[model samples]
Target: MKKIIVLCVAALSLPIAIAQEKITLTQAECRQMALAHSEDLQKADNAVMQAELDKDIAFAAYLPKLDATATGTYMFPDMDMMGAKLQMRGMYLAGISLTQPIYAGGQIRAGNRLSEIGKDCALENQRKARMQVIADADNAYWTYIAVLWKVRMLESYKAQMDTLFRQTESGVSAGMATENDLLRITAKKSEIHYQLQKAENGANLCRLALCNVLGCDLDTSIEPTDTVIKVSLPAELDTDISMRPELRLLHKQVEAAEQQVKMSRAEVLPTIGLSAGYMYFGNIKMKSEVGGQSFTQKIEDGNALVSVLVNIPLFHWGEGTQKIKKARLDLQNAQLDLQKNTR
Candidate 1:
């Protein structure tokens, strides 16, 4: 009696455990969780940050630069003269220098423009990432729902067959129905069982795919709520490709190339700069007398200088000319690509 009671308890616990393992999710919750945990989205966010840093680096050229220097030197005379032995003397110097860019052949301005364009490109990339995530979520949600429906339908069919099987078994024993009827119902039940298994397997695969996207463990249960909102499609799309990010990025590239050409051409122009510095030197003693050493007074000096420079590119083995041609070609290619994509 004890053994029979233990077996019954174990059998009852197994069904309860299985029943407790079911997962339920709503659609909106699934999408939110996926977006929050997606590795691709995280990487896209990092890329945006990197691009912003690059923009900052590019704009740094517009700011003035300050540098400080300190040097100590010990000098030794090459030879003795006038019966005085050559000796080493120590010298210390410190200075601060400032450089402001008065002009730079338009290179700094071009760099700033390119940085802005790059930021726009990064934003477009982020948009693309978001679109991909939403699309993937939609597909996964629909597939899961479809599988659940299929499983329910199959189980309903299985229940009907179970009743028929019992009826046919009783009929055969009473000689009212042939064994063939019972065999047919059993065969149909087996087929339905196989289909149910396949459907269940497919549902599990869909669940795993969703888990991968959400960066969750395979065993984690996700229940999605339905979000099948309907929206009308646009009557027409614009023929011009400029609205697309790929085209926009290409246009920016062309503009950047044109700027580069202009910068290179401006290289032949003159550049002007203004610089200023102040220096202070400590006193140096010449000799030690009875009362005190003869010392030179400390010297403070300030200087301001203005300079203009011109660099004439007389010849560089055709490097500059080649670069200009390349820039023009790139602009043409970008335009063609935009046209192609639009079509």
Candidate 2:
């Protein structure tokens, strides 16, 4: 019975002990947690992955493509022609073809370049997302620390007020202080109490905010183990904006737009391709009679062929030129946007 009671008591106390435990986190740790918790950052990473796949798909245009086909046909009845029966009992064909583009009027190259630019833009966007997350985390961490320090300062001041009130009470008992003075001290102490409570409430709210930023449970207690440090200004400040991710992303956009113009221009140009194929057919029979003689001929054969294909755009009512003009306009717009954002 005693052992069972001890076990029950220990079990009851475990939760209380766990609830009282505080998690100590540093500024760097908080930033790391916030980065891991950021959903936007994760989506940015996914975009980068998708961009890589797009790049690969664009590059595949430069490689050869292989395809296969099979077909079968069966005739239920024979046809009579020229005083004879013609029979095609069953026909089967199998073929495989390989095609490689020799030239595509620079469209394939431009598409690949556009894909590369998209990949670069995705990377830059991811970098920007990381920077934003870190900045938010740092801001939340510093604000929480400031509120905690304010609460500590208010508590210390309240202690000093308490000591003063006690001294004033002692003086009043010895007739050195009046009842009015005692009442004033009492009022001041009450004010200190109210201020302290308010400060504590503010600290709790700040802690909750910090927890939200860190993506942790609201009920979990956190202790920031870092202190605000003094800072000194550098002798000289460098003003350089070229390395910012936002600018890089815009730069990629401009490049992509330029590639789009190239691809549009390619629409009016000629394309060249090479193809090789081999086909096999079997089980085809033709029956006929000539000069009072009947005979059956079975046709089973295979053939291979290689050929070069060329296609040129002839006339489309000025559509190709209009598309190229539109693409050029889009490129110009992209350039203008980049220039505006850079300034």
Candidate 3:
């Protein structure tokens, strides 16, 4: 009798033993996995980098620019001077110039403002992505916990029915219970066994779905260590959408468009720049030949010059005004969208 009971207990433990092979994860661990694998977060990160680069590029417009040029020439035939060759076979010339914008008609400032707006938009988008991924992870995690608990509940119920079936079978042999009671208990045990099977399948499906969210293999199994239960709310939920990232992104876009309009208007205004340049020309050469004997000339000359430059837009057939108009229209559209999203 003891051996028979041992066999029955072993049979009942087989499914539990199999379940032990699955990995166990907590709710926080699941969220971490989801965030690590989220494609939306990856895209948001790229956008953030692009926005930062744009800001740097715009800032560069306010900085000084320096350029240098060098040229060298070799002559196949030497020039003759007073029947004596100049002996200038090769010559190198180099010039370096620096230009700093004293005024860009407010375009540089407006462009910088636009870059700042772009970065704000990108950050808001990243926040939106993170929020969405975290919410999904939370839902998936709770679902896993709920299904796991349901399976556990069904397994416990099955164990109770197993015990009752044994007691009823013994009573039937002692003539203390009817055959109908034994059959009924046996039927209930079978019913609980089937219910546990269904519950376990459900739990496993939820586990697979959670794995999919974490970007893991669908066939991989997991046992959630969290519990799901309804919680009483302390207060009513707020319906305000002002803090939403989509609305913030739209508002930032409107600000950027307004800056673009400022830049366009500035296009018709004059720009002032300061420039400094250094030029050097000449090469090792000989002085004009005298009595057929020449002296080493060492003729190299360099000069530094600074100048102020002004650029005024003379005529563009209303191009600047057209651009400003377009920018204003875009700003208006963005504002309208923001209002709609807010509602």
The lowest-lDDT stretch of 10 consecutive residues in candidate 2 is 81-90
- Model 3 Cα lDDT, one tens digit per residue, 1-343: 9999999999999877765556778878988999999999999999999999999999999999999999887775667666555545678889999999999899999999989998998899999999999999888889878877888888888888888888888988999999999888888888888888988888878877788889877766777766655588869888887898987878888888789889889999999999999999887465465687766566689999999999999999989889989989988998898788776
Return the top candidate by TM-score: 2
TM-score of 1: 0.77
Per-residue lDDT of 316 in model 3: 92
lDDT of 2 at 275: 100
What lDDT does each candidate get?
0.73, 0.90, 0.86
Task: Give me the displacement of residue 10 in model 3, in angstroms.
Answer: 24
User: Looking at candidate 1, what is the lDDT of residue 301?
Assistant: 46
Off by over 4 Å in 2: 1-21, 75-90, 230-232, 290-294
Best by lDDT: 2
| lDDT (Cα, tens digit) per residue for candidate 1, span 75-114 | 6552344433333355456777677777877878877787
Worst 10 residues of 1 by lDDT: 281-290
Q: Model 3, which residues run further than 4 Å from truth?
A: 1-21, 75-88, 149-202, 230-232, 284-298
